[model samples]
Structures are given as structure tokens and as C-alpha cells.
Target chain A: MTKLLEVKDVVAGYGDGPAILNGASIDVQPGKVHCIIGPNGAGKSTLLKAICGMLKVRQGSVMFKGQNLKGKRPDQVLREGICFVPQERALFPKMTVRENLRMGGFSMTDKATLEKRIDEIEERFPILRERRDQHAGTMSGGQQQTLAMARTMILRPEIVMLDEPSLGLAPKIVQEVFDIMKVMTEDGITVLLVEQNALMGLKHADWGVVLDLGRTLFEGPAKEVLTDPRIQELYLGGQKAA
Target chain B: MSDLIQILILGLALGGVYALMGAGLSLVFGVMRIVNLAHPSLIMLGAYVAYWAFRLYGIDPLIILPVAMVILAATGVILYKLVFEREARSAKYSEMTVLLTFAFAMVFEGALATAFTNTQRVTSPAYATDAIFIADIFIPLGQLYAGIVSLVLIAGLALWLKYTRFGYAIRATTQNREAAELLGVNVNFVGLVSFAIGLALAGAAGALVSFVFSFYPSKHWEWIAILMSLVVLGGMGSILGTVVAAYTLSVVAAYVGFFFGATWSTLTFFVALFVVLLVRPQGLFGEKPELA
Candidate 1:
């Protein structure tokens, strides 16, 4: 299959430090929901950083469509139709919600397209629309996450990467966020979600990656990885096989 | 009644200068968490530039005003892109800026001393000696013009911030730099331009104040102290608060000076800052939430 994004033997790290991502490989085909779940410090965030061009890749190649993605700035990667929604503090606190959406269109020169995206996003995400005039900081945690998701969608990115999206949220809000992510994938945008809660992620994610200490220990369909006894022993605190 | 009226006029005029000057330095700190000690030095440089341009080319100080502002604006951008930008990558940027600009302030002062020497310099343009009288109140023509222009500029800045797209980006950056970047706002470019505009405010004020006051290199410390008090008393980065604090401090100073002497005037600013800090350590109109 012609992959939309291919991470072929990618190795990356912070500073002159040892590579946190040691020769990891993954692929995200168009309109596929690929979820990566791993234990603590498995370099989930680091891997996401590498994909978004925040951290320099020490080895191997990252291909976006047919083009090689190396040495590209975060903003450049964004214009290349790759949007990243960070785990926390997604919205600019002091600015109004409408102001935050305008920033999403910074790379788009077409004013009509930008405004139309804003209107569409606000409609799709009612919380953002209701509070468009309100300062983003005053919003609740769940609201902020929803706004963050809405912001990336404004760009109409080829792949939207979310890092620990359910972090620090109530179970109900978590469900709400995941439901939105499901709808997003329905719009034909590939989603790479790094979720620490393996059960929920494996259930919702179409594909599963088991990254242990920054190296992929298992890669297969979500159902098989979730049911695999080995994954249950390590990730699920040695629970009995399903 | 006449004395009270004159005191209000003089106090408000002096306060206008303080508001304009302090706004620039406070803005840099509010957004970047930087304490730019070189701001006062740069303002001095702006003053000197205006002085020279007018004295040599007979260019009206008003006409040369934008030139001085532009020169300082470019300098501010370079200063950020080179030093402050790198330092700002980490949380410790604000703390490091103190020493960095402290050294920079010394370098600027030394340069000024070598060029202008220790001799006193004054911009005694014809307007500097002019005065006006209305009703029972007497006003210096230069002070009246300065006050009016200061109000206009402050209003223009407020409008730009409230209504413009650039203002939205600046506010976003100040709120959260990383989030602003994630949204696709060019944080680096915004930071550079923001720094330049902040410095330009100080430059414009310095040009206006040159007509009213005399200067020496040592005056940098004195002005820095006054600006710190103004910024601290107002709430860092609160534009309206700065204007109010400036006028309040200047009025108190003028009244105290009129009753006592010129020396007693400077003391009022300290007293005001001290009393205000007791109530709100963050200053009046402080931010609702801590950014850093």
C-alpha cells in the first residue's frame, strides 16, 4: 500500500543525549486511525515530536507522502499538512477563542478559506463556537482539549497527531474526546494518537503499536495486540489473559 | 486654586512622559519575562540622536522623531534575534536577561560617555521656553504639546492592540508561547517585531522629553528607577494601569515638591510603590493568572 506517511528506521533524541527513539518504524496510511500505546517513558511524546519536526531525527527517514520530511521546522511541517495537538495547555490562555482559531489559519493566505474553516470548525465543535468571544484560559480542561482538537481540524491536515489527549480528564470527558476523534477519522483524516490507557486506545484504535523503551515490541491489528497475552502481562499489570 | 490647577497641568504632563516610557519596558517584560536594563540606555541614545539631527541638519525635532524611533526599533529587533531569542528558549530566560542587559546598559553608558563626554547636554529648542495661560491655570507650551501628543500615541497603541490582527498574535504569544506556535503563529517573528515596537515607544517618549529636561549618562539610573516604580506600581503590562500610575505618582511628586522642594518629589514615587505593594504584591491590575 502507498503509505501517506512512512517512518522508516527513525532515531531521535534530545540534545546530545542517547536516542530515546531507537530505530523505530511505523506507517500511517491515509484515513487510517493508528494508535500508539506504550508504558511510561516509552518515548511516545518523543516520537510525536520527531514526527512534527520539533526534534531532529538522528537517523533514518520520515516521508510525508512522496516527499522526505527532514530538517523541517514545526511551522513548516504544519504547512506540509501535518498538525500536532499537544497533551496539555492546547489553547492560548489570554486570547479569546476566536483569536486562537485565526492563528490556526496563519499559513493559509486565502481569507475566505480560512474564515470558512473557522465557521465549519465552530459548527462541528459547539463548545468553541459558544465561547468564541471568551478568553480561552477561563475555559474548563475538557473545553480546552476540544478547542485544541478543533484548531488542528481547521488546518485540514493530512494526519492529526494527538499526544496523551485524555490526560488529566474525567472518564466522561475522555469518552467525549475519543468520540470526537472517531468522527475526525470518519472525515478521512489519519489520526496518530499516543494514549497511555492501553485498553481504551486498543479498543478504539484501528492499529496498535507496542513500544517498550522506545523500540517497537509488537505491531499488528488492534484486536490481536489487545488480546495478546504478552502485552497483557506487561502493560495491563500482569492481568490474566483475556 | 490657581496653584492647584498649575500643579495638575504640570503633573499630568510629566506623567505622560513616564507612561509612554515605562510602557515599552513593561511590555517587553510582560510578554518575554525579560528585564531590559538597556531600555533606559537606549532611550538616552534616542535623545542624543534627536539632539544631533536637530542641531546639525536643523531638522525639526518633530520631523526627526520618527527617524529616532525607527533607529531604536531596528536595534531592538537585532537585540532580540541575537541575544534574548536564544536565552528565551528556556524558563530561566527572565533571570538571565537581568545580567545580560546590566552589562549591555554599562556598555551603552560607556559609549555615551566617550561620545558625548561628562558635560551636561540640553535640548533648549524655542518651544522649551514657551508657556501658556488659560482661566487661572498656567501651562508650559512644551508641556501641553507633549501631554497632548502622549495621550494620542497611547490611544493609538491601545487601538492597535485592541482591534488589529497583530495585536491578537502578540496577546497570544504573551499568554502561552508554545500554544501560540502550535496554532501556527510565527512566535519568533512576532517576538522580534514586538520587541522592536516596545523599544520604539521608549524612543518616541525620549525624544519628546528631551525638550523639557537636561541629561547626563548618570541620569540613566535615575530614570530606570522611576520607570521600575511606574511599571511595578501599575501592574506589569497593564497599559491603563501604567497611565494611571504615572499620573498619580507625578501628581503626588509635583504637589510634594511644590509644598516642600524638588528633592522631596522623587521620594513620593518610592512611597507610592511601597504602599501599593503592601496591598497587592503583584501590583494593581495584575494578571489574573501567572503565565510562567
Candidate 2:
């Protein structure tokens, strides 16, 4: 598998603060679901943020498709085929669903191409078509999550970085979100997901990286990591796989 | 009665200019959460620009509106780059902007004082005192023209915000900055452009004010207080609210002037503002204040 993105010992933090991501590193392969699971404050979200240019990287580098993404702004990162869906509800709440979707393609200057992409997206996510004029904030949690995912897809990005896609979601909605990830990987898009739900994340992902206190504890096939006694004890409350 | 109709027309005309002034102030506050105390001074600058354009070039202040807008927009861009840009991303942004813009206002006021020397000035055209009577209600030509121009400009701004791509970016940034950035918006660019547009609106309003009222550099302090009251009554960051509050308060002030005296008319703005603050601190249409 070809490496789509490579992070090398990246040190990052908020201003004048201790490092949240202390020398953390990971390689994400193309067309694969790479999940990073960790306990609170383990810097899973911060790692994703560092790669996407939301947080400033103090040291090391983020390489994507042979280009160094170290100092590029978030919009520049999006232009370079990477889209980040933040943990918070990232929709412009007052804007209509269609407006939110159009804004997702903000980098695209060609109106024809943008409209075509929206049409394609609407066909796949029929709910988006049905509620194109409705405000995104009024939608249910699952529906909003789906819309958020669809909004990023408008750019046809090669890599999607999701920060806790299932955070604060119901179990059924969580399952729906994971299914969307499956759909993304099947469509030849690489996904780098930061998930707090370790068990579900590991089960659905092809590769898993266990993060503990800003350092990688284990990196391997998701099934192997899931079955590992140490990960089972630390993350899964010692619950063995059925 | 004809008397009530005349007062209503006068109130609306005054309200139109206030709307133009308050809109820009409200927008800057909405997008960046910055209370730009320098806003009225910027309007004063626009007035001065219009004053000079008419005084030197023999151009109508009405025709000079676009020229004033461009100059003020450029000034806004430079001001954002020089002063506000660095502090924008800091934790102390809101607090810092108040002091920074207050200082900017003082410097601007001082510069105008140096240039124009605090003498009261008015742009009196050939038709400055011209009036048209309709059904025994007399409307001054300057106020009528300024009122029409203000409404048109305000409508144009509203349409731009609703229809254009840049408008969408501005609205998105206003709604959620991080979300806008993540969705490939150049938020810094949006900030620069929005500030420019806000000041441009101020410029347009200032040009109109030059024809309608006598002004000097120091007049901005009083104007700032009145503009702030309008914005506060309308709710910070709400364009529709600002326009509504402007008309409502102008009419109220007009009635007070008719009933009591012109001096008491000026006092009405502060009285209404205080009552609103005590009863509904968020203003008429404002949402509950978000914890910063």
C-alpha cells in the first residue's frame, strides 16, 4: 500500500503551553481506514489538527503526496486534497443545507464543476436533496453528521481527516457514521479518523494506532491490536472480543 | 394629521442615515467581535473626504459617494493590516480591540483637528436649502436625496450579502470562524474584506451626513454615542435589527422633539438605550450574549 500521508515525530501545542502531541508520528496509506484511538488528552484530535494546519507544529513535518504541509494554512491544506471535519458541529447553523454544501466547495472557482459535484452528492445522499433549503442546525444529530460528511465530499478530497465523527452521537448514529467511513474507503478515499470509541473504531478500521499520553503505544492491523491483551486492558476495560 | 405625517417623513429620513452608520459598526462587531470605537471617526473622515471633494473639485457630494467609499475601504484595509490583524487571533482580541480602536479614534480625531481646525463645516450646495412640498408636508432636498441614497445602499449591501460568494464567506465567518476556515475559507481575507465593506458603508453614510448636518472632528464623539445607542438597541451584529431600531428610535426622538424640545430629542436615544439595557440587555433582536 502506498503511503498517502507521513507524519514524522511532530511536536505541537497551543500557545505558550506544554506540548499536547509530544513527538507523535503515524503513516496513513491510500484507500484505507486508519483509526487512531486514545483516552482523553492523549492528543488524538491534536494530531489530526497538527496535520491539517489547525494547530501549529512546533517540530518535525507533515508530508502529503511528496509535499511538505508544515506551514500551509487550513484552507491551503484543503486545497491540497485534505479536508478536516472538526469534532464540533462544523455547519454554518443559519445557512441552508444547500448553502453549507456549496460552501464546502469554496475552493472551487468553476461554477459548472461545483454545481455538478453538488448534484452528484445530492444523488448519493438523498436526504441532502430532500432538505436542501432547510437550516442544517435543525436537523437531527445523525442527519447532521451525514450532511457534514457529505459537505466534505463536495471537494472530492483524496484524504478526509475526521475528529471524533461519533462523539456525542447515539449508538445507531455512531454505526451510521462508521458506515459512511466504509463508503468513503470503498470510493478510493483515505480516511484518518480520531475516535474516542476505541472498540467500534478498531473493529471498523483496517489499521489501528493506539495512542497513550501523546505517544503511540501500538500500531498494527486493527484485528491484532483489538485482540492484544495490553490494548484490551487499557482501552477496552479488559473486555475480550466475542 | 399633516403634522404627524411631516414628523414621520423627517424621522424616516433621519433613520435612513442612522441605519447606514450603524450597519457598518454592527457588522464589524458581528464578524470579528470587535467594538470599533474608531468607526465614527472613520465616518468623520468620509465626511471630510466629501467636504474636500465638493470644496475643491466642485463635485456634488452625491456623486462623491463612491469616491469616499473607495478611499475609506482602502483606509479600512490598511487599518486592519496595521492594527487589528495581529490581535485578531489572540485570546485578548475583544478587550484589545476596544483600547486599540479607541486610541485610533483619538489619533484620527486629532489628525482631522490639525487639518480642519475644529471649525464647524457644512457642504452647502445650490440646493442645500431646497424643499419640496407634497400635500403641505415640506421635505428638504438634501435630506430627501440622502434618505434615498441611504436606502439604496443599504438594500445593495443586503443583496450582496445574500447573493454573492464573498457574501457567503462573510456570513459563514460571522457564524463560525473555525468552521469557515476548515471549509476552505480564507478567513483572514474575509476579515480584511468585511472590514473594508463596513467602513465603505460608513463612508457612504458620512457623505450623506455632510450635506444634511454641520460637522467637525469633535462631532464624532457625540455621533459615536448616538450610533452606539442605535446598534445596542438593534442588537449587535444584526443588520435587520439595526435598520429597524434606527427607524424606531428616530421616530421616537422626533416625537420627543415635537412634544418637548430639540435638546430633549438628543436625550431620547440614551434614555431608550438605558431602558433596553435594563429590560433586555440583548436588545430587540439580539440573541443572549455568548460567554466569550
- What DockQ values do the models have? 0.53, 0.86
- Cα lDDT of model 1 by residue, B217-255, tens digit: 767888887888888888877777788889989998999
lDDT tens per residue, model 2, B46-110 = 99989999999889999999999999999999999998888788998989998988999999999
lDDT of 1 by residue, A93-121 (tens): 66788878887776787878988999999
**Clashing residue pairs, candidate 2?**
none
Model 1 chain A: weakest 10-residue lDDT segment is A233-242
RMSD of each: 2.6, 1.5
Query: What value does the lDDT take at residue B194 in candidate 1?
Result: 81
Cα lDDT tens digits, model 2, A189-225, are 8999888878888888889998878888789999998
Off by over 4 Å in 1: A16-18, A238-242, B237-241, B272-279, B288-292
For each candidate in turn, the TM-score is: 0.92, 0.97
- DockQ for candidate 1, C-alpha atoms: 0.53
lDDT, residue B240, model 1:
73
Q: On a 0 to 1 TM-score scale, where does candidate 1 land against the true structure?
A: 0.92
Deviation from native of the Cα of residue B32 in model 2, angstroms: 2.2
